[model samples]
Target: MDIDLNTLRASIDAEVNRREFERLPARDDDSLPAAGLIDSVAAFEPIDLEGYLPEPPEEHQHIEPELVAELLPEGRFYNWLKRPPFARHLQRPRIYSLLTRASRLPGGARLSNFIYIMARGIAYRIPALARLLEQSKQWRYLPGRLAGFEYQANQGLYAHALAVQRNERYLLDRLQRLEQRLREQQAQAARTAGAPAAEAASPPAAMPADLYVDFEAHFRGSREEIRQRLAANIPRFKAVAALFSEPVLDLGCGRGEWLQLLQESGIAAVGVDSNPSMVQCCLDAGLQASVGDGLAYLQGLPDHSLAGLTAFHVIEHVPLDVLVRLIDEARRVVRPGGIVLFETPNPENLIVGACNFYTDPTHRNPLPPALVAFLLEARGFIRVEIERRHPADPKLLLQGQDDGLVQPLNRLLFGPQDYAAIGHAP
Candidate 1:
């Protein structure tokens, strides 16, 4: 459908004219550029009010709330309300502003960025919500529609606003954990430095010569699920894996899935798994597979030997103390400017703790994105990005594989609920 530019223009003119009539500004009003009016109109034009479909029915809306937030007057919702159409730009920022200001100061840039990111999801969903608005057969009150939109928008806007404002507490708590972990790693490194060369030469934990048996036990019959997950991870893994331009290590590479994807993408890859049967299976597939402890395995390698390393869903299994050791060892082996891509199940996901969290008996706890980002930043990583993924339903998690794809079905019946954090070494 196409946007009814005329309707938009008429609405703007009516609103602007009404505002001017109520409180006519002097010559200053005439001097103001007409660009603001046009821009605002354009912002609202993209979203097809299906019930009020302009003409075009794009899958997504044109007015991005983030852009709207940036355009809104002085970033203050209160001021916009006193104005005309600007007051209804999006209800989220206003609610967030009120809640955040009242509780405490928000986390400067990070907090704002975080809220905007979540708000973007709400904006994307607006088209669907707008569709519902249009189809509300009995709902004929324009004022009621406007109010409903405003209330729904506000709900989306402030869904996580309070958390971002309160993120500072988590930040401080994470920093302390990092500092303490570093001290322990430093002490361990010192002791290892003094060990006899031969003692240090002992081989890292060995993988079983045959891994197929173990692969069968852990992965079992989920071949298609493995393929889908690997495909999803390939591009991300490649983003960092390609940097090394050399054979890289995939620590805790589950079932050698990622390694296979990397190899197909033409990056040389070796996988190390702690599960003996998994190592054997991968090796039988003609891949270089080893069963080993991740940290000890990294330490035994020559310093700066690796171009990159990947540890997906690996660190969560290690205790907090061992986590630093793993990162430290990764730093030592990877060349300067090398990349490390770490991903784990997001704790914020509804089923993560309740269902998927128990899939692996070894999983200690859900890894919150904020906590992961904090740990990496303290460890001297430069760029950090946190992402959330949709968790597979219990059918997929428990049955190893489901003939019916449960993730999409659950998202249809439910919604998304997974998270991840990515960071780079300085």
Candidate 2:
């Protein structure tokens, strides 16, 4: 070949410039380096020409020559058989329409249900076959689509299990606390047993020994008369009779009239009194009775030990502090929804408050109905109410007077001779 002198001279100059450019250091710009370029041109070594060639697109890339040679031809017939007919996208709509129409026919729903159950049973029985069937839908990526649904279901189950465990733990903790409190109360009672009788009889301390001596003989009425007066309260207790499944405690149970009445009504009752004579009378009448201070007896019992507590004409004998402690102990010892009833001379009635109240030397002071009711509420009792009882005879009222003062005078002179403060434990 013939060479042009001018072109040859230009090519020699370009070759000299290219070698100089290759020897220069790389630029410090953010742009990436060319493929196969080393950190520095000074350390670069020439690679094989084949290694520097551009790679073919992945879609058009060929397999290994030996592997391609071993692969047998996948004929039209084999491909057709390999693909599942039900899974074909083109036929799915037609198959679904046919199934809907068949299901509309009589008994078709039952037949379809039976088939679905059988299919599930077969899948469970042949897990390997089930896995193979699932693999056929790999193109649709069923597992990936169902992943979120499965995660949500598992979360719900976990939350429910956690809630149940927490509730069980809470209930167990409450039970343990109650048991501990009961043990503490028992220990306290044992300690108090060896103490002085005066300490134990805290409430009755307001009453002098002279008052307790022959007090029942001088003040207590006949059993028949007391029973007649107490009979009116039987119906009041009947409504909540079922709540007294456990024994009811009657504090200051004088003469055992209330105990006898409870026995007639088929309710189990126990009596506590500071007076040994009154307790003996209860025992002699086949009633369970104990000679102990009402407040101390209540303190000795465990939480929720009693179903009901009743003290008739007893609270008036105790001081305010003693009455408060008595009510507090009653609240602790009584069960939830249990009854607490206190009957005392009504201070609302002028005759009772000024005259009849002091007839009993043991009475500390007459408690107003409002004060008693308020105390019950303050101590966490519910449904507190004051029920006035033993109204004065109508004949005792000033007759033939249309004046408003007449009614007021009668109320102040007579009104209700006694009142009861009734409450229920929360």
Candidate 3:
């Protein structure tokens, strides 16, 4: 058989337009012709309309009614109508019979055959009432077909909503890709235009600044929780404060919890962080803080300017070279007999080392307490010690275990979640 592509294309286009038009609400002025009205009335009878009515468009034919119910404006109302008293009344065979018969009548006759069948089946027990209903004239004009119309309307709305949602997602994805491409182009242009050779070399992937701040806020606990945790370190810092005259400095002072604790203890303190929002939070609380790279801020300070230096949960986020330089700067700035503390997630805890350490995308790698202590000693700090804090909950440990293997197993599974390396400036 010869194929006519133009005719097939025209037919498909017409069908698409027809379906789109059917999705629209009926106008008040539109009137059905006598013959069409008769056909419509017959279509609403107890007999199946599925064969008589046009099949739904391919895209909408498989849509589940339950999935689309919430997207419809009258969804709640429809759900309410399906419950108890209203549903019981609709289920009466007398009412359903009347609707089924009237739907076949002329002039304003509209009713759902599917609903009639459903109601008839439910009310089949009351044969006498059904017989009485067959003669009733009062319900002949009832607009029971509105239920069928509502179902069809809901399906159309759901299909339209799904299409719109897909379109929006596609546009958003495209916009993000465009933005990424634009940034890459700008970086390349800068590299070609007299930028430093080192900077032009392969740079590390950086998370968006705002996103990182929000990520930290979500994962790093509330300010009150952090303050409570840092309270344990107060005596340690207080001892160093008594020996030195200069103020303490906290690098990456997220929310300035340590700074606040030190100030409350009558020890002067200052803080520096790269996140502007965190610095703003500190400033709002009447704490002294500035927005800058922690190591860069340390480098700017004169030798023996600070009494103590602390960085809590900050080292894991930086490169090894940056961490070494930060330690070197801490030693140069902190006074003799003053302390330099570096707190980090303890990789000794098997769970923390293998899984939890990667929760923060910014974390470079887990650093062991012994490695930090060695680094501090190598940088000329004396009396280097490791303070294991925030141990795993006692309930997680193996109970009633006297065996040697059990103790070691418990330690491996439920050990200190974090640790701090404290080294004195010599």
**What ranges in model 3 sit over 4 Å off?**
1-205, 400-402
What total of clashing residue pairs does each candidate reach? 20, 0, 0
Question: Which pairs in model 2 have colliding backbones?
Answer: none
RMSD of candidate 1 to the truth, in angstroms, is 31.4
TM-score (all chains, Cα) for each model? 0.46, 0.53, 0.51
As a whole number from 0 to 100, the lDDT of residue 359 in candidate 2 is 84
Q: Write the per-residue lDDT of candidate 1 for residues 1-426, one digit (tens) a residue.
A: 566778877876776566544443345555664433334433333333364555543223354544545533343433444355653544454444443343233533244544564565575579985576566644677678899899999988797787776797789767855864575467457657873221111112333324433533564337556566657756755665556665678887656777777778877788887766666667777778786776667767876787678777776776676676666666667676767777677656556657766665556677777877887777656577776665444454432267478654555333445455666555
lDDT of 1 at 1: 53
Model 3 lDDT vs. the true structure? 0.72
Off by over 4 Å in 2: 1-220
lDDT of 1: 0.61
Task: Report how far off residue 159 is in candidate 3 (Å).
Answer: 99
Give the winner by TM-score: 1 or 3: 3
Query: What's the lDDT for all of these models?
Result: 0.61, 0.72, 0.72
Model 2 Cα lDDT, one tens digit per residue, 1-426 = 344667666765666556655765586985645654444446445433453345664434443433321331233422342256523421333333333344444555344543565565578679797787678767468777689789999999999999999999899767755754674465467556764322332235456544554565565566787799889877756655675577788998877899999889987789988877667788899999898887778767887888888999888887787687778778888888888889999989999999989987667788998899998887668799998988888889886567787888888998999998999887
